[model samples]
Target: MNIIQNPDSTSLKRTIEQGTADQRIAVLDIINEVRKNGDAAIKAYTEKLDRVSLRSFLVTEEEVEQAYKEINEELLTIIQEAACNIRDFHSRQKRESWMTTQENGTILGQKYTPLDAVGLYVPGGLAAYPSSVLMNVIPAQVAGVKRIVIASPPQENGYLPAGVLVAARELGIREIYKMGGAQAIAGLAYGTETIEKVDKITGPGNIYVALAKREVFGHVSIDMIAGPSEIVVLADDTAKAAEVAADLLSQAEHDERASSVLVTTSLSLAREVKKEVYKQLEPLPKSVIARSSIESYGAIYVTDTLDHAIDIVNELAPEHLEIMTEDPMSLLGRIRHAGAIFLGRYSSEPIGDYFAGPNHVLPTNGTARFSSPLNVDDFMKKSSIISYSQQAMLENGRKVAAFARLEGLEAHARAVELRLEDL
Candidate 1:
């Protein structure tokens, strides 16, 4: 880790992986093949890429039972408890259809409707994240989404990870698919023989999966084009160097492209955190990845004051922001952008990732400035309600026609005028 007196905009800017031209072309090819061949194309890709041949992509009840046996009762209990927390948190975000009456005899309102079906793409191979399952599924379930599906790549043994399966089972998510990468995205976006199409897709994957989401966006709704994991620690002199360093490395180990930054007012704390980051990274199992991330993207900025540090944080709009200052709550009003904020040292970033009940799937790579964390609202759509009484239509219909004609839409004007004449 490097410590600088005052870092500039370029130093703070983090880059996300945008797939290469070849990868994009490959993704398009896979999508097109799936659209044309459906199940056959998916099977071919699974065999070629995953090195496993399968006649069916659906996970059978027998396999789900086997997955339960593979995971111990203690870990299963933990996953169930996490699911309850997630469900409870998202339940508060549930919305109901509402209407308001006006003096002019018009009813105006909004109707909230849950999406019929949604597909969650959990990453497989190298590692399996049961946490991702709890974070993504619980919100949709809370929103009353009837059909929730899980799609993950199968290992060479032709089975999804035990943790992944166990988590899905705990959530009562029975529709599981053994597919991965662009093909899994394609299958979810466009219906195949075994896998039905979904109204929306959410979850995270590699560069290929991200690109596939971009390609299939308009066809079906998507959460967001997520980037690599990121963390920005806004600390002051009161913050401990070891605790801050450990928190930063928690995100850096996620990927070589992951970013971990520290913005502080005290120069002493900055140097201490920089030293502590290296000392902690030495023994990490993913030290090579974390070290690469730290050397390439990590930085410690020593600002003249806490206000200046907060200004820099707003400018970066990082995915995860940790405030380890003396009074973390006091700075809450100043923070304008962050996917998730961890206040105080005890409220570490991992708390939100696994068990704290907030969705771990968040906007990344400066996207927090405009987007938001996944919640129940993401699984629901809104429809505007409009009912104008006869008297109300007679009063506003002419103005509506005039406004439509102002845009040179003759039919739109006539449509309103025709109703007005009847009124």
Candidate 2:
């Protein structure tokens, strides 16, 4: 990992600006081809990229049952428990339609409604992420989405991972498809012969999937155009270098494009953690990926003060921020942006990704600036409802008519005036 000081280095800034106009437009170009050619184009891309020939894109119910049966009892139990926790937590976020009635016979309220159906594009890159399956589907289930669909690439043996099937089943999501990448997203957006079009699509994928979501936005709602995984640790003199190194490596092992950074005021600890990262990297199963990610995007920035460390964190707006410092809670109110915050040395990024009750489907790159982690609200809609009685219209009709006339909307003014005449 490269070590540097604050504010001047361009590593984080360049990451935000990495994707260019040509790369972006090329993604859109691929999406347009997929939309025009539909399943045929998707099959071609699957063969071109994944080097896999598909017998069928859709998986049968019997296949899901087989996968469930094949999954180990222990892993199944874990998925069930995680799903329960996720469901229990997100259930708290469920909101209902409500109205307020006034003495003047006027009623106003915002009604919450669940999207009828949603598609989940599960990425088959690096590894099959069962935790992501839980994060994406559980909230939609909690929001009462009637039908939930999932699309993932098949293994070389023409099989979906047993863990993924088990996770889907645990969340009451029955529809499963053996499709992935931008093609899967395209299939979800524009309904294929076998796949039903969805109101929204949620889940993480490669750059292709991200671009496909961006292209299909007007056709169907999407979670966000997520970037590579990243985590930033803000530790102090009180923190442990080894623990910090392990946490950083957890995110680094995700992909070659992933980033793991440590911001601290302790120069000695920064050096210690940098050494620990190399020691830990040697033993990691995905050592090559982790090494590449760290070498390319990792950093250790030493600040003169803790407050200065925080300023850098806010500027980065990392997907995951860990405060492995003394009195971690004291700085909670100071952070303005982060997809998820893990406090203290014991807390790590993967905790939120797997067993933690919080959603792990967070906004990547610097999107923590505005976008939020996937939540129950992603699967719901809010409607504004207003009803006015004759008396209520008569009481305030002139203000309404005058306001419309001020905008030169004479027809809108007349519509309100004609109703007031009944008074």
Worst 10 residues of 1 by lDDT: 8-17
lDDT of 1 by residue, 1-423 (tens): 678777767667587768899999999999999999999999999999999999898999999899889999899988988888888899998989999999988999999999999999999977889999999999998998999999999999999999999899888999999999999999999999888899999999999899999999999999999888999999999999999999999999999999999999999998888889999999999999999999989988888978789989998899999999999999999999999999998999999999989899999978999999999999999999999988888888899999998999999999989897776
In candidate 2, the residue pairs with backbone N, CA or C atoms under 3 Å apart (3 or more residues apart, or in different chains) clash, namely none
Residue-level error in angstroms, candidate 1, position 184: 0.3
Residue 344 error, candidate 1, Å: 0.3
Q: Estimate, for each residue in 354-420, the C-alpha lDDT of model 2 and write its tens digit.
A: 8878898888778898989899999999999999987888888999999999999999999999988
Candidate 2 Cα lDDT to native: 0.85
Taken over the whole model, the C-alpha lDDT of each candidate is: 0.92, 0.85
The numbered model that scores best in TM-score is 1
Task: Give each prediction's root-mean-square deviation over alpha carbons.
Answer: 1.2, 1.9
TM-score of 1: 0.97
TM-score of each: 0.97, 0.95
